[model samples]
Target chain A: MAEPLFDRLALIGIGLIGSSLAQVARREGLVREIAISTRSEKTLERARELGLGDVYTLDPAEAVADADLVVLCIPVGACEATMQTIADSLKPGAILTDVGSVKMSVIDQIAPHVPDTVHFIPGHPIAGTEHSGPDAGFPDLFQNRWCILTPDKSTSRDAIDRLTAFWRGCGSDVDTMEPGRHDLVLAITSHLPQLISYNIVGTADDLETVTKSEVIKYSAGGFRDFTRLAASDPTMWRDVCLHNKDAILEMLARFSEDLSAMQRAIRWGDAGALFDLFSRTRSIRKSIIEAGQETPAPDFGRPHKKGRD
Target chain B: MAEPLFDRLALIGIGLIGSSLAQVARREGLVREIAISTRSEKTLERARELGLGDVYTLDPAEAVADADLVVLCIPVGACEATMQTIADSLKPGAILTDVGSVKMSVIDQIAPHVPDTVHFIPGHPIAGTEHSGPDAGFPDLFQNRWCILTPDKSTSRDAIDRLTAFWRGCGSDVDTMEPGRHDLVLAITSHLPQLISYNIVGTADDLETVTKSEVIKYSAGGFRDFTRLAASDPTMWRDVCLHNKDAILEMLARFSEDLSAMQRAIRWGDAGALFDLFSRTRSIRKSIIEAGQETPAPDFGRPHKKGRD
Candidate 1:
């Protein structure tokens, strides 16, 4: 049998991503010993019941002690506090990483307090569903999905390679990007889509003309599609929005500007302009499908099929 | 089998909705003969090849002649032109209905041309997917969906009943609604979702930091959900925006206003407000699932298992 990638790994905040990493890492023999930590005893107990880790603890510092790798799996808003709590106990030469969505903010928050001897390589795993918590994750959550690493010039090549190797072992294609660029790219691709979904659902909820029952009843047509993203964990997403403010706000501004132009074309009945823009966007979806980034309809969710990523 | 609903029924556009109607209508013996027509000669030929109808024609007038029911199955933008072309050829007392997304504009366009002898009842089958074309349709497309009728006071009860029975034969539950209310309801439920989807896809495509490949690759995380709606037929959605101007703009404005408030909350790191709104919207999705209007992963392309949908 092949040797495991790490002798011991510590995962702070055993939620969706944390539990998912534990499952996949164990399934792939990526680690021998796993330590799980969370502030809530209920979640810690739940993680232990699920057998997500070999050991579960309530202390982040205790979890990180004697570990070769430590991954912060908490919400972005909780990153700074978790870093402060664990900094004193992080083993020297251990590679520290995070499975956060917003890179720049995470780096800004956690980089200042980390000890120089430990490698602090920040990353965002571009994967997840609307579901949250330990129960929500599975062993194949990162398969075929991109896990981006945003490292600085001062970062050691050995640290990047070790982290990259770990993600690959757990079934992720790795891409290294600048922290700011990562934030911007994700602002458009992930953050904005979620914001739009949440906002639209909120708007529909507030409407007087359409009864909530009617919206629910008739949602199969199109509205149902948005609700899945809107149904994502509120606390986690709230932290994401607050953490990635600038880029999200910029994307929002651009979206509103484009939407106003579309509104004008609709008001004046400019079919040509509306048709042209709508057609152009259709091609992008085709590309996304052709590139196999998304499994297109009827195939993406084959009944009782195993997870792709 | 019961007597046919009509001696002949002409479908003047053989796309997803049109071909699906033809398939169900034929499957249930709802009409003695079906006349299929489209502006595109290739689509007409394809319909003929699929055995979708007894006669296929590229000419709208030729298709409508001698038919007891003439359904305009084309995009909303072409309704006026198709009505103008077929007005002189319509058989007396024929029931004139449409499957357009926008009701008020459709009534305005086609009602003026209908002769006093004919009964004009505009409608919209609240069902469809992003896929288009004749081959993309199926017989069960309308099964268990709502088919809304927007008939005015001048419409005869016999005509309404016949139309309702025809939709029932196509597997839809039928309901009657005022044209304006139908438009507003659809704006919130259907049009707004499509518009927001298109705008967000466009925003992602226009992003500089996120390369197209990166966006496509990471899309499954969240962005791919919107792509299905964004991939809808460009001509159809363009017409929806043009014809449903007031309602779409109203919904867009409301959506933007809510987005601004959300932006402010995120900027201020107001986790409580964000969590409240986000969590509240989550229950609506639950209601939609309970209502059986959606699957657990609604955007997933799989045909939901029996008892799940």
Candidate 2:
């Protein structure tokens, strides 16, 4: 274990990311004391039962009272309210950050509420499983993954360095970008794909000609891959859609236009167009695997549970 | 080892499924002699180098000349020409089958050329990896997967039972359905998902607002899952779209309608609609897992390699 970086680390909203931070911080000795708080009582109990924090409370203000580092791990839509609740109680000179997926809206909503005495450095860790909640948190969730911080010019360099060091301690490679740019990047990479998956699954579910059982039965054909993303937490994804509206809609427009072109190719039986697009996309997957963003094995390298693939 | 089901088996196209049939058939002693043929001479050479078959031929007619069972494992669009090429050479009373994704189209294309003396039973094993070609084939590709056979009343019971036994030997659970119903079912489950995946990847590639490197680096946010299906063979997917046009267009229309509604919800900040859909879809993933169609691991249960999750 390494020396503690902060006297106390307070995490508000202990869901997947929050619980994961608690696990990694405790395991890596990044903080001397971990305080967990959430608005929901049941989730707070679950976090305490999991022993994810040293101090547990439902009051956000109490959680961050003396904390040297405060990380908000709530829904992106809740940032403003959460900041309003705990802003005045933040320790003087404390480094404040967050793990929201949408950075632009988060900065817009929460930055005004933050005090001048505290450093508010908004961050998003580009890592998670489809599963959520305290039980889903694993110590290695951030290992080898990216943790991006969106810090404006007004932010202190010392605050940014400390947060970067904290993320690095949790096994993440840290990168910094502008908040608006971060939102645009994540909208295509994260938000748009999720919305598309959820939409297609809903389409299959609402089909009149096809039975749901049939969809589930032959899902191995290709449908099961989409289900993984569709199975993600509803509250989290809903908030992502609401908070990252402009970028999501912009990407959706482009995606829909592309879909129309693909549909026309199918209608006219343009095999060359379809084949060229499909072939080029295959190379992108290869690039992603080569860059270490994805696994190389077939079927996402699902383990041999019943038999070999 | 199981007793030989056929004295000789002819595979007309030695790609992914054909090469896997060669491996499993040889490994399980299901066929005494394995004959491999492909229109592409380079593929035939690769299959021969991999020792996927005992007899290698460049002619589909030569491959099926004396074989007791003939399997067409080419793209759905190629079935008609392949059937025309091999019709005169098929051994009398031979069982003919295929591993195409689209069943009704395969039946429509190949049935007329088949002699009444031969039993034609179209089949699709609801199993595959995105990777294709001879090198991508493995002996256990069909293990614990479903193989659906679409046989009309004119199809002899004896032929259906034999093909069922063959798939069972390859470690698959066999089920039979009508050809038309099979097309509709696969349209929603396999074809639609594949088309959507290809479309999204293309959309991301063509995006000017977001850089490609950002998409690659932040793919773990959810975009990477679709890339797996998008990486599938261009020629194979092109044929599927062409052969299954009606069903695919129907599904695409429904998918587009649903996507429009979802877009409206996000535009209006209908968090309830988004949350409800997300919640309902999660159960489908659970059902797929419980039905043994998917792995029960977070993040597709991707195996850890050099680093962490």
Candidate 3:
């Protein structure tokens, strides 16, 4: 309807985020031709079955050939290797970008391998669920969500504009950020939260006192909230932790220190201190809701079949 | 319709769980008379406005007098004080119970203060939201959820049967467990999950690099799940933390150890280890669904307005 945003676009990994992007892009006519690629042959075959893209391949280079835009959607650890494999095949004036959780390491790893002729804009769409693989994705995943871009100082302005337009066409609100700042923000907002969830779920699994059946049966009370997060794609998250080590370790240290103080207060039976801290955090949830960042639910991990809010 | 289960039932608090119990109990016509008591005058007034109980009182002793059942619904830290105030007023052979998160501490606190004439059966309902106060409750809160009872060895068999019958009247599936085992099970299922949520949110709040706005705005990705648990009533959670210190601390230590191992794997870029753990957990979610412990959702916190799941 609006003269499709790109003539041809390539998506290098067709997992949850990638598939969702493909769906939304198709729905909005963001690209005329979509080229999908993944290292796994099975996944590539599945993508073909789903008719996710016009061209599907196991070769990263062939996927990017003649593409006006290329988005790397693989785990962070595979970024550099994939970049090396596709560098020679990328269209000279095409824009190359990635949907990585951490931006600093991505820029560090893939920027040097890319040709100076192609535009390399690192990005992350702040959207996903615990479910992975192609089938888990949906068309509206990026709607009303933020898509952060971290372009280097030497980057071409035209490329940044095109990338921003592409994201906007995909139903995302795009924002530009510095690479270092982007990594730091995601470490707190995404990476740190994921690590804590994984850690706690692991703790519950190993406890001799609590049988696994009991934990699962009574999870509705509070624990089920963490399970969704702990259920996240571990490979992607593992790569995120390794790539964003310093910020994550820093946040973890701060978390441990705060937890110790809470433990001490609880041990001493200082109800006032514990209550005060807990009460203060209430404002943050309020802020999130007011900002339309979350929906208020009466229960966690359960769908409300009757009420609509 | 079946006859009312009790002539008179007294509730000692009117927070989320208590008020929900009152609403459901009334809607189901489970009791002929409902007497409500809370230490806070304003909360009592609010409960009265909601018509949650037939009789309202600021005094626990007065509320429990001549009642067939007395349920202590206050915070864990207040159990001993409430037990002291109501012990002498309990009708002979009346079923006395509490809805405490940690069972062992509640038993230790209230048992000594209660008279031998009353049958004390402690319970912990495995259902709730992060919300609190009388207004935060709804009628169907306990439906399809587990309600665990921890009866002492000295407790009468008839008392256990009656209490089980009463919970069923309120639409809960009742299960019997020892006090110590209940505490340990809940520590992993409820306490540790909450602690991790609070700690991670605190970690996000204290970050220097990640602006608070960024965290709030992008929370829909995964961080929003933790906020629901973190948003729970501060006083109630504080008491739970203080009362269940030993089990919580032990679980925390195990969590930290598991986190270190995960960190190591991430540093080594071990995708195999990550995939193995991630893949194994998906089955647990499937098990929970098969067990009818969870509902599949289109969005985690949103009420499903659409017909599709």
- Model 1 chain A — which ten-residue stretch has the worst lDDT? A300-309
Task: Write down the DockQ of candidate 2.
Answer: 0.75
Count steric clashes of candidate 3. Answer: 0
List of clashing residue pairs for candidate 1: none
User: What lDDT is reached at residue B292 by model 1?
Assistant: 56
The worst-scoring run of ten residues by lDDT in candidate 2 chain B lies at B300-309
Residues B1-309, model 2: lDDT tens digits = 868999999999988899889999999999999999998889989998999988999999999999989999999989999999999999998999999999988998998898989999999999899988999888888888899998888889998998899999988999999999999999999999999999999999988888888889899888999999999999899999998999999999999988889889999999888889888888888989988888887888774322743
Clashing pairs in 3: none
Residue B132 C-alpha lDDT in model 2? 88
Candidate 3 chain A minimal-lDDT segment of 10 residues:
A300-309
Minimal lDDT window, size 10, model 2 chain A: A300-309
For A80-119, candidate 3 gives per-residue lDDT tens digits of: 8999999999999999999999898998899888887898
Chain B TM-scores of the candidates: 0.95, 0.98, 0.96
Model 1 per-residue lDDT tens digits across residues A29-63: 89999999998989999998999999889999999
> Candidate 2 lDDT, tens digit per residue, A159-276?
8998999999998889999999999999988998898989888998899898888988899999999998999889889999998898999999999898899899999999999899
Which candidate would rank higher by DockQ, 1 or 2? Answer: 2
Off by over 4 Å in 2: A304-309, B304-309
Ranking by TM-score: 2, 3, 1
* Residue B47 C-alpha lDDT in model 1: 93
| The 10-residue segment with the lowest total lDDT in model 3 chain B | B300-309
Poorly placed runs, candidate 1 (over 4 Å): A298-309, B1-7, B298-309
